[model samples]
Target chain A: MIRWLLLLMLAAGPALAVGDPADQLPNPAQEERARVIGRELRCMVCQNQSIEDSDADLARDLRRIVREQVAQGKPDEAVLTFVHERYGDFVLLKPPFKMATALLWGMPAIALLGGALLIRGMRRRQRVAPGPQELTQAERDRLAQLSGRPRE
Target chain B: MSEAAPNPEAAAWRRRALLLAPLAAAGLGGAGFYAMLRGLGTGDYDPRGVPSALIGKAPPDFSLPPLEGTGLPGLSAADLRTGKPMLVNFFASWCVPCVIEHPQLMRLAREGVAIMGIAYKDKPVDSLGFLKQRGTPYARLGVDQPGRVAIDWGLYGVPETYLLDKGGIIRWRMAGPVTEEILAQQVTPLLRRYA
Candidate 1:
């Protein structure tokens, strides 16, 4: 039981370290909002991590910026636009649907439709396929003769 | 009895189409891979390269103080719009890549290219020492001790260089150290085109 408790604490450790206590907003609601926005914003320095989750200096700076904006009562979209203006679409984890990203956003749907069509086509082919036919009387008699048995 | 067959003409066309589908996909993938390899060789399509949003826009407003103990003037946003193409290099004293990139900057300076330097996240004393050792290639040097200006410029890391057109619009940004090959291949062509 002690070992399991130790393992659980180890797993919980990283989650506890996410946002620095000093970086949090005074109001819990505002802090929560800041975290929501931070999670959506990519840490440009870390490439694969959200600013809220990364320990990089730039990420920490971005987190502070987000909390500051939130504390200032700026709307979520306004705060996002502030960052988006500087970092471009790459900083948005969810790339906004645009002409440049149309193919990227459309690929999954296209693949799904293509796959459905392929399965449908295969099913249709299986249904139309020829089945075995019964042997004629003449063929049956020939088979019996070939086997060296008296014709029945 | 066998189920009715699909329309003969349609079936034949569909069969051939199905047969060609994998080949077509393979051909497209091969072409993409070939382009990617070629891009890799030319340093053109780095998966890590983040295209700057600052391109075609003015640099963010900033007025950084000159590095202490250095006699160079401080850099400001207004200074960049002096009706000539210039380079804005963000480097740090501790960044090894900056040392590698220094010779290229020196050569450009010798050829009369206007280059501005921002000492990002480094002590002014260290920056002064680094420049003194490197033979100072910048026309103006600024110290961004807290790196606030760097964040505004969307700097990813140290040793990033931005090429500004004559209008002060940023045309290109490189996130790594400049090399002789990069100078001859990318920088020279862009300088001529923008000039």
Candidate 2:
């Protein structure tokens, strides 16, 4: 019975270990920062690949730098700024609010405003247009009588 | 003598239609957003699952400058057919995955696997600097700076390795990091079989 239990436990050990690789890593705080930084930074070697997805040598190096900076207690903005200094703005998908990135930053607001204006315009037209309800009581009664209802 | 009231159901329906216009717009907008995500190639895909054109076909034929520029000779697909199987790795100095896989690559080189390296989309100077620091495991090295050669081989990203047979046809291709287990199970058997 003990032998069977040992075998079962041994088999289950590796299965448990495979669950989440991140859990085995040393620091969760640093790892989380690294992950956040990685998603922001574009992989220089692969076109369209973020650091998180890239397996390139440079991606690994950048990931190491992120972890190191985080472990050293660097602020998120500071770490990002440091990397940006070396890599430039192209490295970030969500570019900073700046002259060159004005379009990207302002797009959502512009869309919202435009939509609001369009809906407002539609509502105004609907309000102004006379419908069947706009008719006077006498007109409604006349129409109803014409349509064979009891005349008032 | 009583006034005729409006058709209550019809009036309610008109109100409901007004309410539903925005809902319909929202549904259409949502579908459009979903299509944009997929159509723009931004959707998620496992890099490892991406198929390589060179997997079953003959690798591209080309020559490159040696590490030392020793002028010994350049490597080509023909070099793969020398009675022993070979491994060709496409890497760049700038790729992080390539760095992670470097130790494994170095071990493979030490094991007399007869590896060929391709420098993809990198400057010659950078490539040389990388090999210098990393220690060259590549029996032969090729430079593909224009990236035309890599595209021809259907390479999506860096750190892709191919195992070619004695006939220069690719037997297997690995798109991501090659672990020790992959080398032991998949690569070793092929190498031994070809040998």
Candidate 3:
């Protein structure tokens, strides 16, 4: 009798184990946390969108990989590191500041400084009185015509 | 008539403002260009660093339609809790990478690795046509029109494959075309471990 019961339990094990979508879902808290993390990651396949936004197969695979890693008790940083190792910096929306990627980080500041200097230089140039040589005879004539005065 | 040239102070202020105008314009122009460069994704384009929400969590539950005449519906991560492990591949008819990885998928399928394909964000007819032309190695295929299903899976693009163990836990995943080296080194070993 016990053996028959054990056999019955074994037969029911898989049926019990098979879960519907609601049953198999991760905890809500965990899902929210994962969603936050996913939002920061770039989708390797889709150029502009975050992984959270993309529906590309590559994106889905990436999400599954992230979920598995998290479930395995890997830290968020470690999970990112694993992906980065495989896909290179291009897979990241935010590239770290490294020798290979330093330009990306530096460009904005460089541009701002350059812009300020150009503005300052233009201001200085604008302040400089028109050089005596600025007006050619043709310009003088045009000015005179416009002013209704004789050309000098 | 106005006395000589303007007062020295007025002339200096006028000169300063005039000089500053172009300089300010240049500065604005530079800033605009900088923004443009950043937005363009430039050579710095990288996606790996993008954080993932699914990381460190269980895969979402989802299903796909079966390939033609397989009778079985598409396999899901939930279904993977069965006896053997499985692989899920996201592909599209228009994707070059899908073509590149087609043979790899076929080999896995032939080895009884339980590989399934999701026809991601593609037209059904085109996906079917692609399978006809390239030979379907997928045990089944699910259509993901408009890519919402892929989004639910957190997909970035097509040609991504996920490995699930007998317990329905994801074991491995690949982002791009699965090179032979990758298959030999990473996927095959994982399968053996799970097997």
Model 2 lDDT tens row, A1-152: 99999999999765642213442237876787778877898776674877666666556656666777788888989888866654457667677788978988899999999999999997986666655558799888989988998866
Reference contacts reproduced by model 1: 0.70
lDDT (tens digit, per residue) of candidate 2 on B1-195:
232326778877888999999999999999987786664343233432544534567776666655454232456656767777888899988988888878888998898888888888787778778877987878878777766566456555788888888877888777776666667767788878766
- How much is the lDDT of residue B175 in candidate 1? 90
For all predictions in the order shown, the interface RMSD in Å is 3.0, 12.4, 10.2
The TM-score of chain B in candidate 1 is 0.87
Worst 10 residues of 3 chain B by lDDT: B43-52
Name the runs in model 1 displaced over 4 angstroms.
A1-17, A133-152, B1-42
Expressed between 0 and 1, the share of native interface contacts present in candidate 2 is: 0.00
- Residue by residue across A23-123, what tens digits does model 1's lDDT show? 78889999999999999999987789899999888888889988988999999999999889888999999999999999999999999999999999989
Better of 1 and 2 by lDDT: 1
Look at candidate 1 and tell me the lDDT of residue A92.
Answer: 93
Here the TM-score of candidate 2's chain B is 0.69
lDDT of every model, 2 decimals: 0.90, 0.73, 0.69
To one decimal place, how large is model 1's interface RMSD in Å?
Answer: 3.0
Candidate number of the best DockQ: 1
Candidate 3 chain A minimal-lDDT segment of 10 residues: A16-25
Model 2 achieves a DockQ score of 0.02
CA RMSD of all predictions: 5.3, 15.3, 18.0
In CAPRI terms, model 2 is classed as incorrect
TM-score of chain B of each: 0.87, 0.69, 0.67
